[model samples]
Target: MKTTFKKLAMPAVATASALALVACGAPADDTATDETMADETSVAQEPGTIVAVAQGNDDFSTLVTAVTAAELGETLSGEGPFTVFAPTNAAFEKLPEGTLETLTAPEGKEQLTSILTYHVVEGAIDAATLTNAIESNDGSYEIATVNGGSLTATIQDGNVVLTDAAGGTSTVTATDVAASNGMIHVIDTVLMPG
Candidate 1:
């Protein structure tokens, strides 16, 4: 395990290694108070995790709220080095009227989690890598999300575009927003996994 992480840069590797223990199911229930799990919570307070980054950035306020509502903070912040196609605040605003409200409601957590996970892919896949994959796959690439759904990536007018499961399209407005445990690519529109 140690040998595998030798490739990551300084801060990210340290964060990933420490959080990974808790992420891999270190049992944090009241009956089994694992030290690692407690440490994970404290570790999340630092600025390396994706959740921390999102919380610190005003542009991702909506995304942060959705993540919290879905109860995916620990997973996204700890069990990763993930590639998250993060929707910006403006992107969340592009949702249908009342859509965000409905999704954030407690009853909508499962569906919201599914939708959010559909935007995440394992590993730190940067834009250049995505572009290469698209080119290698003959101008498009079918990338599977953390959820069972998939996203199709294609280039449009010199920009990377993602086609969601519902056939709605979103352009990648920004690429490679680095987080300690992942990379965040900001998208202008929310991709639904309908």
Candidate 2:
């Protein structure tokens, strides 16, 4: 009985070690079985659309509301593959008095739409792409937004920062949030077009 238990424990320890190595990006040992390695590395797929990703998070409720009010819910929910710089609820709160409320109003839909479109670049741009673009462009990369304006991107203090058309600068607080349709980079400030 003791010999049987010892044999079982040795294999369990080896399996745990292999999983730890895989997580650290170490090359798997030739002795590691294919089934165990596969199980340890599998990741569940997330939803595809930008709208779906935003709607799933509480931090994006304000953004979701604005998108709906701007009548862009359908557009964003479409086959976008768009890169969105999403501003959180707290970011929206930083706006002047009555700004968010007014933007969501029926009368302000067009304005709201413009503001939202200003945050979207046509393709999914990950952090690495932005960094590469910046390097190729002499430390700053200009990105054209859906609103027809441009944003200047640079790396500052190790974070990706976007300078809007109005010269307002917003730092990306989170990056590379993946969706099947595209990617999302969360910003600390709501970017406005000039």
Candidate number of the best lDDT: 1
lDDT against true structure, model 2: 0.76
For candidate 1, the 10 contiguous residues with the lowest summed lDDT are: 1-10
TM-scores for all candidates: the values are 0.76, 0.77
CA displacement after TM-score superposition, residue 11 of candidate 2 (Å): 35
Per-residue lDDT of model 1, residues 1-194, tens digit only: 00111122323433342233233454556676567666766665344677877786788899999999999999998857788898999999998999999999999999999999999888888777788888878887888888978899999999999999899999998776667787778899999898
lDDT of 2 by residue, 32-147 (tens): 77776565455223344788778877888999999999989888887766888999999999999899999999999999999999998777677677778777777787888888
Best by TM-score: 2
Misplaced by over 4 Å in model 1 are 1-47
Error of 2 at 137 (Å): 0.8
